[model samples]
Target: MIQELNDEQLERYGRHILLDEIGYEGQLLLAQKRVAIIGLGGLGSPVALYLASAGIGQLTLIDFDQVDLSNLQRQLIHNQQRVGQNKAISAQQSVELLNKNVKTETITTKLTDDELLKITKQHDLVLDCSDNFETRYQLNRICHKCQIPLVSGAAIRWEGQVTTYDFRKNKQPCYQCLFPLKSNQGSIQESCSQNGVIAPLLGIIGSIQALEAIKCLLELPTLAGKLTIIDGLTMELRQFNITQDLSCPVCS
Candidate 1:
């Protein structure tokens, strides 16, 4: 059931309302949307802030890591004061401060497949901001099973990529389609801790993730089956087509 926006919501979202693309009806639609962010780290920071500010009805923030002093450089949702707090809890507080309208669920423990599927079924979309391949593959499989859209991003050492896999749409590529499991050992763990990332690179990638997520929620054009690569060092932007792998273990 759709709830009417109060006077405050009308006033709060006036700018969005002014746009022809997102008039009153679109704003109303956004208020009924639910989004889940799989991590509260570098890439998840801006995604959460923007979605919260945009008035997404509900947000699920999942992160088992705690905020560290080193995380302050790139993770904007956490601050110096929250250095030792769990990232999901810290992010929830940040969202509350940004927009009280968005209901948030904070999860601090790693989720099993059953737990993930249960939560995935409750939301409209999922954004992958995790650091490791294990988490990404897990999210991909669950989202594929649920037939919901997944917007995923990765940033490390001045380079980043963002993509959307809309399992709701038939014949689209999934995450594993783009990066197949090649070796006996999983993909190399090329983390920022091992190789430092520039402060602003995450913002660029995460902002795109947020934008694409909104598009998905709004039923607009998305980057499904496309990978956007951004290089901060050379300032080069490129997009490559991601075809559905015939043997894509998940999507096909």
Candidate 2:
């Protein structure tokens, strides 16, 4: 279905239109894409907002959390007035306010294996914005099985990481391939909530995840087989090539 961009859409996406890489055709592709973002907290906030502003047609958000006073520091999608409301619903409100052309679907319950498989199959891409390893691994597993692209991001204190898992491409590593099990670095095994992350760090990682999703949806070349790591303190970014492990339980 060809969607003619009205005056409002053209005005809203003027900068995108100016980009040589993402001309009118790329913009149209974005408008027809659907992305599922798991977790509407710090990371999901920027990803959802950017995707909506960029004119992504459909966005499915899953987060069992409610807006809390603590989340205000980093989770920009929710406000004090929305405290006690579900994060997914609050994020939906934020996206709708950003751009009415974007459709938002809020899932208020925790993501289960069955729900993850079903919801992931319906989207062109999946954003693993959740804070836990279990959630990230589960989303990657489903995406790999369904041959859907997955974008994963994380931030803690002065460190951050973002990667694209394009299972549709052979020999590309999924999240589980890189971090098979939870890191033994901490008692809880590297959770953002417990480890603490700088407020702006989420913005950096989340925005990158959004960019990766856009690139993946438009079939543009991206950081599919590399893990991009960031150091917030020094503002240094490094890329590590990742290869599919034949021993990986998810892909092997």
Best by lDDT: 1
What digit string (tens of lDDT, one per residue) describes model 2 on residues 1-252? 437777888889989989999888788888888899999999999999999999998999899989999999999988999999999999999898889988889899986788788888889999989888767767878898999999999888899999899889887887877876645225436676677889999999999999999989988888898999999999898999998878888888
lDDT for each residue of candidate 1 in 42-143, tens digit (9 for 90 to 100): 999999999999889999999999999999999999999998999999999999999999999999999999999999999999999999888888999999
Q: Whole-model Cα lDDT per candidate?
A: 0.92, 0.88
Report the C-alpha displacement of residue 79, candidate 1, in angstroms: 0.8
Off by over 4 Å in 1: 183-186
Candidate 1 contains a number of clashing pairs equal to: 0
Off by over 4 Å in 2: 182-188
Span of ten consecutive residues with least summed lDDT in model 2: 180-189
Whole-model lDDT, candidate 2?
Answer: 0.88
TM per candidate comes to: 0.97, 0.95
Query: How many clashes in each candidate?
Result: 0, 1
